[model samples]
Target: MADEITASDQIDEITDQQFLRAVTSFEAIIVSQIQVKNKLGDRLNNAIRAGIIILGIIAVSLLILLLTLSSQIGRISNVVGAMNQDFSTVSVQMSEIDTAMISMELRMKLLEGIAGQTQVMDQEVVAITADLETMRGTMAGIKSSVKGVRGNISNIAVSIDHMNVNVQQMGYDMQRMGRSARSLNKIFPFPLEY
Candidate 1:
């Protein structure tokens, strides 16, 4: 009976030790898992921070590009305005030329009336007629030149309109880019807090 009791006690002590070892092993595994979780969290934080930095750089670059494009568009608009003013000045000059041509026509008619009144100046009359024909040819050439200038101005106006449309489209694209940047900012909040 005493031997049996000692053997049972020994077996009980061995089982107790085994249970304690299993508990210790489980604690070690839990600690290891906790360390792994911390490492993964740190890696995730670093990745998020890097992504935010990259997005910030992209946003800044887009802003700079938009500003540059806006400045260039302003310069182009100023140039177009100057061209319009120049066109107006040229139109005024063309009007003055037209008035001068009318005045010259009136003077020629007066000269013709005087030459017809004196039949003794037939040679002078022929010379005056030749001068009038030359003036007519010159006026025709001036008219053709004016027409060509008007056509060129029309083409320039069309081109300006096209440029304006392109600028408007670029502005819309810039707005969309701004919205996208804002959305990105919202998705990735700043990790640092005040």
Candidate 2:
């Protein structure tokens, strides 16, 4: 009976040792699994935080770009508006220029009419100049005749009224020539007698 009791006690002790070893190994496995899960959770949290920071930076950059673009758009709109205003002013000025051109056309017609008459005026001036030369020759002949008449003062006064009439005609012609010369105030565009 004592031998059987000792063998049973030894068997019980061995079985209890095996059970404790198995339980300790299972506890160790459970602890390692919990550590792995914690590491995975930390990694996921870090990745989420990094993603949020990148998203924030991107959002800020987009906001800045939008602001800058809006500013540029506003400036472009102002420039376009200014150009439109300038074009309107230019259009008004163009209308005024058109009116000026019309006035110039009328002036050009008047100048053309005057230019046509200038030739007729030139021939009249030549005729008048020829008459002056004839009168000068007649005056020279009269001077020679007067010089030859020594002490014939009675013949020099051949009716003062007749001489006055001839002198008045010459004076009228000279006045007409003077008026024409004043109107044509050019410096020597054609052959002119001194």
Candidate 3:
């Protein structure tokens, strides 16, 4: 009976030891599984955070590009507007130049007409000068004729004075001859020598 009782006690002690070891192993497994799950969760969280940061950077870059493009578009619009204004100004200046050319052409035509009139006037003046020279020559000839007529009149007056003096002498001689003839006839009236 003592041997049997000793064998039972030893068996009971062995069983309790085995149960404790099993429980310890199960607890160790549960702890290891929990640690592995925590590690995996940490890695997943890091990857998700990295992906979000990359997406944010890309969005910021896109926003910056949009801003730069808008600025460039504004500068291009200003250049186009300036070009349009310059073209309008050039068109107006061209019209003014055209008007000035037209006015100059009109003035040239007027000058041409005046030049023609001046030519005709010059020819008329030349003709009048010739006519005046001819009149001067005619007047000179008339002056010479008048001088010759005055000389002839002076000679005629001198000849008429000489003729008047001869007439007076002839009248005196005729009276004396008549008186002598009468006296001779009376003195010789009684003496007739036969």
Candidate 4:
């Protein structure tokens, strides 16, 4: 009877110590779960902060790119203005060329008119030369006719002087014969003289 009572008391003490160990183990498990949850929350917060910083950097870069694009657009506008000025200058030069061409065409027409006048003058000169040659031929014929008339008049004058000399000698002979006949009538009688 004494040994059975001692065995029952040792079994009760063992049950009480096992109960305390089980309670301490349950509290330790709950603490470890809380620490794990807190660590996970801190990591999530850090990740969110990193994401926000990256987004800010991207937005600022996009703003800078937009500003650069605007600057380039301003430069392009200036270049376009310069090109417009060049085009206007070219148009003015083309207009000047057109005016010069018109002037040249007018000058060419004037030259053509002058050439026509020159041709008419050349024809007039040729006609004048032909008329002068005809006048010279007429003058030469008149000179030849005058010379022939002078030669004919000189020959007629020579023939008339020769006939005048023969008439004078015959008149002298007739005078001598009339004187002889008078002398013979005086020698004959008074009747012959009467």
- Tell me how far the alpha carbon of residue 165 in candidate 4 is from the true structure, in angstroms, after superposition: 99
Q: Indicate the residue-level lDDT of 127 in model 2.
A: 56
Give one digit per residue, the lDDT tens place, for model 1 in 1-194: 99999999999999999999999999999999999999979866876776687678667766765776676567667656765665676566567666656766765676777775665356556765665675666567656656755665676666567667766766776676667657656755775454
Residue-level lDDT of model 4, residues 113-161, one tens digit each, is: 6676877656655655655565455445445544544554454454445
lDDT score of model 3?
0.61
Model 1, residue pairs in steric clash: none
Candidate 3's C-alpha runs over 4 A off are 104-194
TM-score of each: 0.59, 0.55, 0.52, 0.51
Candidate 2 lDDT tens digits, 93-179: 455555545655655566566776877656655655655565565556545544434223333333244445555755675565555
Model 4 CA deviation exceeding 4 Å by range:
1-12, 115-194
What is the full ranking by lDDT, best candidate first?
Answer: 1, 3, 2, 4
Backbone clashes, each candidate: 0, 0, 0, 0
Full-model lDDT, candidate 2? 0.60
Residues forming the 10-long window of minimal summed lDDT in candidate 2 = 150-159
Cα displacement (angstroms), candidate 2, residue 176, comes to: 99
